[model samples]
Target: MPTDHPAPSPRPRGWLSRFDTLRVKLFLAIAGANVVLVMTAYLIYSWSFDKGLVEYLNKADENRLQPMIVRLAEGYRQNGNWAWITEDRQRWQDLSREVLGTGRMPRRPGELAPTPPAQTPSDAQPHNPSPQAPPAGAPPSGPPAPNVPPTFTIDPRLLLLDPQRNLLAGPEGRTEQAVLKAIVVNEQVVGYLGYVPRLQMVASLERVFLAQQTRTFAAIALGMLAAVLLNAALIARWLSRRLRVLGDGTAAVAQGDYSVRLPTRGHDELAQLAEAFNHMATSLQAAQQARQQWIADIAHELRTPLATLRAEIEALQDGIRQPDTANLDSLAQEVSRLTRLVEDLRLLSLSDLGALDYRFAPLDLGRFVGHHLNDAASLSGTPLHVRTELEQGVEVRADGDRLDQVLNNLLQNTLRYSASPATLQVEVRRHDTEAQLTWEDTAPGVPPAALPRLTERLYRVDESRASASGGSGLGLAIAHAIIEGHGGRMQASASPLGGLRWDIWLPLNPEPANA
Candidate 1:
């Protein structure tokens, strides 16, 4: 018993592989590079732009708050009274609370009070609360030791400063390093003050930054996409122009005008391909001329012999050469020759029409080869050494009858053309979802010049030998058709034994019906 393992399946292609065309690949590559470059530029611009904007806003804010602090200090000094300072402080604090959002300032227990707003410090405002006095015998609160204002409200935006650098009563204990200008009056500082606008303008700054970033990124993305599309369009236009030229050239060649040439003076791959195409056209034109000449020569050769045979037969029928075996045999032979030529012409016509029938089924390749080997050995009369090296139980979906025709033609060609005592080697191998079969002979293969046209009907390597050897020159052509009809391919090349090698490739997975 043999193993019944199925053949491997073909690998499924990914989405990327589906766009394997050169045009699609090139366009996608261009677009991808453009997107990466645009995104990188946008990120760099936004980072630097936001930093500079923040610095400028901070500086302008400090200038605006400077004057307000100086005015409060002057009124307290001129009056020499803490009452005016208290009144001023209350007014400023209230204004600040309205400007910057109001929230309870952090305080010790009992520090917050329900006391009426301070008026004149001398109006029995009861000196300083014991809790307010830091035991340093700090001067009575109000104007800063005669010159500095007792208390003053600085801009909340100026909150970014170290406590040691604060020259005005900063809202609370909050401090930041952005505070650039600190205020000082007389020798002693009345209260800490400085302006770092980030404290007050951060919300506005964040909103602006966000909006800028969004706009910048969005613009870059869209701009990049537009640039890519434009570039692709230009590239496509140029490529399309070149391709159109090539298409026109191909059409001309198809119409039998083989004098087509493409412009190929660039360092691009397209130029190289164009040059190569022109070379191919030149070669084909030369080959066509040779083919036309060969056909004329063959027609002349065929006509002379046919005319002579017909005349002799007519004369013989009229009792010219007594209808003997020699004369009748000669007549019969000529008819046979004419019949073979007509059959060859018919095979070529069918191949051109692409008409071939195929009936497919799962076949045991080893058994198929063995059966054919028996027939070939029996018919050839010479004991053919059949060598079969195949993976056991390998099955293929193919047309068995068509395959039999293909094998018979190949074997017949081998027995007729190959040297005596020839051996037939059949090998069946599984490769992915395809099965490859190779048949080799022990005689010299056809010449290299004839290799390409071996499957062409009536195309014999030696026309002289074709007549003498009784070859119709259509066997290999028919074989090629049968293999192709079964969704397979057949090719002839040099064999391992220095003879002809006919290799056939068939799909193990049968194509679906109607596919």
Candidate 2:
């Protein structure tokens, strides 16, 4: 039978992994560099320290050796022979201490300052005052210890010997070492100072001090690195924090929350990005509102025609109205209104889908305007007093039919909206590399606030006005789209003639002089 056992959970990460981010990585790199710096400093210090120590030992050796040789030869001259030092271990040991060690001894090793001789008590026992240990198996006296070495350091094992290589001072256990230096007195070699090679004196205190210096260097390096790590971490964390805010804002936007706005901090790249994002969000919100308004307006416009058609049909079927010419004409008018709205919408959709075929060709802009003016004489609409000043030889590349359609839409709007007997001015001017067309009319100018969005789709200057004037309110919008497709601009402003002004700019590469 299988037992019911719980599955094991994944292990938690170690503390080090918690800092495994860009911030920590940058800090670690600096820390590694600091460690290398510390090691290099230590190695360099050790080399210099050892070199200085050797120099000090060599100077001490050179300065101290001659004094010691002179003192030993003086002892020999006083005794008239080597017998005074060679036969006595105490004499040799005392002389060695005064020379190599810092302690004082008699100028002559065996001699002492004059003092009056005194008799000792009969019951007094003799005592050995020297520091050397008692003979091998002698009685264990109270706390006797071995003698201290002669030199200040442990490395130099000393032996004093005659010119004949006869040992005098050092321990017999170290008799096998070679002669390290010959003692010279007045250009004569009397004896030799045999020792192990002593290159430098590195005392316990100096070793401890060197170790402390190394630790100090390491500590300073670690401290400096820690400071850098903290600063770097803060910088990285700050950058990441700003980016996280941007990421969260973008996510909110994707979720259809356009109200989210980010704060711009410094004048850095991230700050500029935040500013752009806020602008984008504001635009998106405005566009969404516009989209909603467009839907409502379309529905309202379509309903008007649809309701009329339905009402007319119902009236005829219920025997309320006969199919007279008047009723039939009313049906035809509604059908026509519906047709115009559909066609306008179809044009807009086609333009949006980039499927509109434009047959572009070069045209004389001034002549084109003059011809359109003559053609407008046959069309019936609101009356206008028209004037024209056409600059000749203004050449431009455009679709002639589309350009004609744009001018017709503008003329129709002017005739429909302007008061009767409107003053109209149409002018074509060649300005450098572009053609400028201005159509300004008198009175009934568009409002200041409404001017900005005058070319927006389905927008009208007067909302309370009736649609009986025969326009889908997309004339200027369609014209604007066409101009944009032709790489031009179309805008409406308050005319200098105290009326609504439509300005159109078309790109032109000026007609050649020969033509």
Candidate 3:
């Protein structure tokens, strides 16, 4: 028998995966750059410090050996030869001790000797004690002594050489790297004082100071790096939060939540993106609402005609009405109305898809309007008083059949909707580079609020321009689309004649001379 077991839930993301987001990546990039920069600076500072310390110690050694050079020169002057120092090691030691003022023998290798203190005036006159002298080795009791130059203990590396550069005293076999100071007497070179150049820091205080400084610098670098990391993390988190909001908004829109809006807080690119997304969402919401309204309108329009036909046919089948000429004619009219609505919808779709076949050719606007006016007058079911103000030679590039269709639709609307014996005023003129046509009818003007949406598909005024006028409401919409496809525009407004006004603008064909 199988035991009942619960399903395993999803495993939580590992720490590494959790840090794989853009925020973490950005933080790491900033931290890595700071690390590289700090390490490079530390390495460069250490190298420079080491080089500068070696140079400083070498210079100090040269200064300390200066007094020794003078003493060696004075000895040479007195002796007039090197026999006194060369033959006697004890003489050389005494001369070096007296000149250096340390009163000590030369130190062996690896031995660290502290620098001797500066000499007081009393120390120079030890044989005769003065009344002003302080007790032996007691701290001075008076105003502080004047600042003295620093002295270094560098005797272990000291070497003496003759004019020929042969070592005479001190250490041996270090001549190659020794720095020699000339021992001169009366402007004539006699012998030389030399010492080996310092290769590394040897003083305990210097080594301790360098180590402390290194630790301090390392701590400062780490502090600065920590600050940079904190700043980077904050910035990354802020950016990531903003981006996540946008992502959520986009996802909502994808899921058909058109009402989703993002917060636009600043003038940055991210803020601009949020604003654009909000605008797009608003447009999508409006389009969605319009689409639903359009479907409802289409259904209502089709239902009215279908219901009329169905009711009449059912009456005849139930023997409640006979199939007479008037009854058949009523049914035919409903079918015709349905057919027209379908055709108008198809035309609008074609225009939307850019599939409308337009054969463009230059046609004289004046003559074209005059011909259509005559045709409309001859075919009018009710008497329409027509007036025309045609400007001759006003030409435009347009499709003749399409232009005729537009003109017929306009005339039909005027004849069907306008009161009988209504006066129709038509005007054609040239306005700059465009041919303008204005059609105005007398009385029954459209409402002010309904003027702008006159070209919207399936939209109708509920008062004088209602569906009872036997209009499919797609005529003006189709006309608007056709005009737009021809690179022109159509507009409606309150007419001066107290009816609806239609303004049509078509680009004028270039004159042959101007072309």
lDDT values of the candidates? Answer: 0.66, 0.75, 0.81
For residues 171-230, could you state the per-residue lDDT of candidate 1 as single tens digits? 565455545543344654444445544533346446566687779677877877798778
Candidates sorted by lDDT, descending order?
3, 2, 1
Best by lDDT: 3
Candidate 2 lDDT for residue 271 = 92
* Superposition TM-score, candidate 2 onto the true structure: 0.65
lDDT of 2 at 18: 71
Per-prediction backbone clash count:
17, 0, 0
Cα RMSD of predicted structure 1 = 15.2
lDDT of 3 by residue, 170-257 (tens): 7888887788888887897777888888787556556777788879878987887788788878888888999999999999999999
> If scored against the real structure, what TM-score would every candidate get?
0.48, 0.65, 0.73
User: Predictions ranked by TM-score, top down?
Assistant: 3, 2, 1
Top TM-score model: 3
- Please identify which of the two predictions, 1 or 2, would achieve the higher lDDT against the true structure: 2
